[model samples]
Target: MRGFAQLLSGFLLEYVPRRRSLSENTAKSYRDSFAILLRWLADGRGIAPDDVRIEDLSRENVESFCLWLSDVRGVCAATVNVRLCALRSFASYVSFTEPAYLEWASALRAVEFSKSPSGEVEWLPVEAVNLIMESASSDAREHAMLGLLYDSGARVSEIANARRCDLRLDAPATIRLSGKGRKVRIVPLCDQVAGMASAYLAATAGAPDSPLFVNRSGKAIGRAGITYVLKKHVAAAHEADPLVVPPTTHPHALRHSKAVHLVEADVNIIYIRDFMGHSSVKTTEIYAKISSKSRQKAVEKAAANLIMGSAYGEEDKSAIMEWLRNLL
Candidate 1:
């Protein structure tokens, strides 16, 4: 255990470049999975940090741990899979260098990734988005955050870690976002989002080195702080009365809603691709699923074409008619 963690950590740090390293989201995810696995081994097997051995995790234990995570802990399978992958990567690293667990590494490689996914979380419903956006208090940090999320389609963590210098005041209002893999992408900011961000920047324009948004003490925005703002004000803004039950919402749902809205507007896939800064055009393709209304409009436009052979010459029409008759 002593050698495993320390060695793996050192190697990963060496391999993953500081500036071009794993995306912030990926780092967070790997950390979470490693924590869970370390806890399970320590508590369940009574293995000390120094005494732990990779071979201690029998093939059966690896599979069992995954199932235990999903069933007992109430975690979704996708989450369980993520943890397994992280552990596997660490195990592979150990196997290559330690030689003590070469066979264990082979066993680890035998484990197959899940093919079919489970647990489908629907994006924010139309009404829910309206409720959440309207829930924010006017002229405040939360309100500005809500507008930024909807308008920019940024992740919660991104918004939480945004800096004062990230905003580009130039035309088209592009924002320089440090995405996953330390990959920086420039996302164009809409006028409304830019206006709100400008206001926020102005209010807290303390230093270029400072955070774009802060709390009372001028500290960087924390996850819980942003969640509190969203739950209290943003979602509540959706209700007819702020005191009443407001829109129940989640961070990703708002992003999904924004994508769906763009899809509905017939925005080109490539355009949305750039706006969302997705790693691949394939990921953005999901949004192209047409709504019933859009489908209906498509049918309406093609309705004239349904009058088969109308544009053909009378003889050609007769030939098409004959072909149709023969098929009948």
Candidate 2:
């Protein structure tokens, strides 16, 4: 049985030998994506890569594959979408390279994929943030770690890999994060976050190029460390409340809260994109729903305030009180 690579090499060598290499990153992405696809085809569908006919990727097969990803693998929608995208690439490849398979590839157009909702991220209220920040340990590390998330709105991967060199602490402070696909984006730090991070950096005992964040074990902070830091502080804050609220903590919520705060402040949407390292504005659209809800609440509060201060303020209130008394 021939491997998928062998088939591709044979076909390309026999026919389109003149095809130049695509961009290194693109070729790598395609290779990685398609390789997983071929493996899935052989293992899951019981079809050898060489024997995988164009019809192997029929609409039924595509739907079954998505189900298998969720049921068998327990993957989330975003992860499933990545694999589906790989299939689309294969379909696109088949369309041009193998005329016979064009219909099979085109049939993939009928397959529907559920997109992840933009509301996946939940931001806490600004009032709640004050409690969380205040709950941080006296340790500068804790302060800086928590502050950095709000200041940078960075993904977890970027935070784990953050280094001192990434910071540019002049006016309009910035830190560079190496994001997905090794893309670099500079996220400006607010003055408070910048100052906290600088103090933490100065207090840390490590090499200049060592991890910017460390845990109790004296190692660089990882996902678990980040979670631990957030949960403990959040629980403490929740316990301190006179209301005795239930503890609800999510790491990404801090990042989301930052985005929402900026949007509410009317920051330029494009600047938010650049700051957040969002490759597409669609990725940044998560705030639309949140902002709209907030706007409605603000308008309602403003209307209440206006009525309280208006000429009919007393008369209208008296009428409402009379109606309430009658109902009672």
Best by TM-score: 2
Q: What is the C-alpha lDDT profile of model 1 across 169-228, one tens digit per residue?
A: 777796666667777777777786787777777675577767777877889887777777
**Top of the candidates by lDDT:** 2
Could you tell me which residue pairs clash in candidate 2?
Answer: none
TM-scores of the models, in the given order?
0.49, 0.55
Judge candidate 2 at residue 202 and give its lDDT: 80
Residue ranges of candidate 1 with Cα displaced over 4 Å: 1-121, 125-131, 241-246, 290-328
User: Which ten-residue region of model 2 has the weakest summed lDDT?
Assistant: 14-23
* lDDT of all predictions: 0.65, 0.70
TM-score of 2: 0.55
Candidate 2 Cα RMSD after full superposition onto the native fold (Å): 20.8
